[model samples]
Target: MTRVHDMGGRFGDGAVVPEADGIPQLGDWQARALALTLAAGALGQWNIDVSRHARERLSPADYGRFSYFEKWIAALADLLVETGVLTEEDLSGQEGDAPHPLADRVLKAEAVAAVLARGGPSERPSNVASRFEVGQAVRTLRPAANRLVDGGHTRLPAYAAGARGRIVRKHGSHVLPDSNAHRLGEAPEPLYAVAFPASELWADPEAPGDEVVLDLWQSYLEPA
Candidate 1:
């Protein structure tokens, strides 16, 4: 089996480009069927009401990949439930109440398939400002009382918080769930990846003359 790393190169946009031959083989009909099934699962998991909505949001290429790896989807669903990202009730009609470990694993695979159908990790919406053009000055929002624990706060990384930066590019809009709690589902918000000079982020006497780009949500900014 070819390692995933051996399969593709990372594009400038952070997307992977699998080698042409690296793509697995599947008939058109089979691929379409898998896409349809995975779309259905996404609707159930995300509480999305319309099947068309799920399909419209997903990529045909990603859908085919999901079809090719059905087992992986089931495993992911199990993991999500085990980790409390989902509930047993979510898997109620899907599978039997077997041992938690086994049931969870099965559900994880199913849920993963749904996520793949929904465009995988990269496709989620964000909330960051696009109002600023390139080279525009912007101020980072101050950290709120409850900071994000999974790393640092959302929209504003600690180094950039309270710091000023230039908007290097516009990454468009995406869903901005409360990063601190990730509750309230998700809401559409503009997204931007601002560039901050390394010297600016760190008070280093001697550091590489490189800049760090942060994917900031719109809510994390005020006028500089």
Candidate 2:
């Protein structure tokens, strides 16, 4: 399902602005939000996919209104509560007498650099062969009949639905976000770089010669 956050190929929003060079764009609180998110995620209660889904689940009005980091902080709080790490009272600033539930798992200040350096890797070993080969033509799955309903988190962009493309490269196998976001098993699948002409995706393409390449999974494609 298409949510407000999926802004790909949409018109009239505004021009993209590049961040100023060497200048910090975020405030201290924004930095804290990022740190808190990473720290909470380190506890193993949820994965990156789950956190992304939490942000997407925000109400449309709130999603559109809040600034970027604001959304992150809000989503983080909700996830903490939902996972039983924090209570509603904790969020409301009522200090508790009991010890923190995840105190042992707290990301330590001394190990911050090591944790950041050893980034999370999603690619997993797969014994199954890839379904499509380079130069093979394929098409993305069309959107469901009910477009407004939530269909969980997905990496497929709404604009790319039903679009025709060709496999430009293979990325081996990786965790499928559709299942991972819902706490489902990480069903690894062959990922490919599929290139689609601009004309195929847009009705009135300003630059028809250009192409858009998306890293798509095997399940998202079929013989064209």
lDDT: which candidate is best? 2
Question: How close is every model to the real structure, measured as TM-score?
Answer: 0.46, 0.93
What is the C-alpha local distance difference test score of candidate 1? 0.53
Against the true structure, candidate 1 reaches a TM-score of 0.46
User: Candidate 2 has what TM-score?
Assistant: 0.93
- Candidate 2's residue-wise lDDT over 1-224, tens digit each? 58888888888988778887896767899998989889888898998888998998899999999999999999999999999988899889995789876789888999889999988888999766788999999999888212222577888888999999999999989988888887777888899999999999999988968999999888888889
- Give the clashing pairs for model 2: none
- As a whole number from 0 to 100, the lDDT of residue 91 in candidate 1 is 71
lDDT score of model 2?
Answer: 0.86
The residue-by-residue lDDT of candidate 1 on 105-169, one tens digit each, is 34354467556665634235444335677778888876431243332114344456676788887
Shift of residue 126 alpha carbon in model 1, Å:
9.4
Off by over 4 Å in 2: 144-150
| Residue 145 Cα positional deviation in candidate 2, in Å, after optimal superposition | 9.7
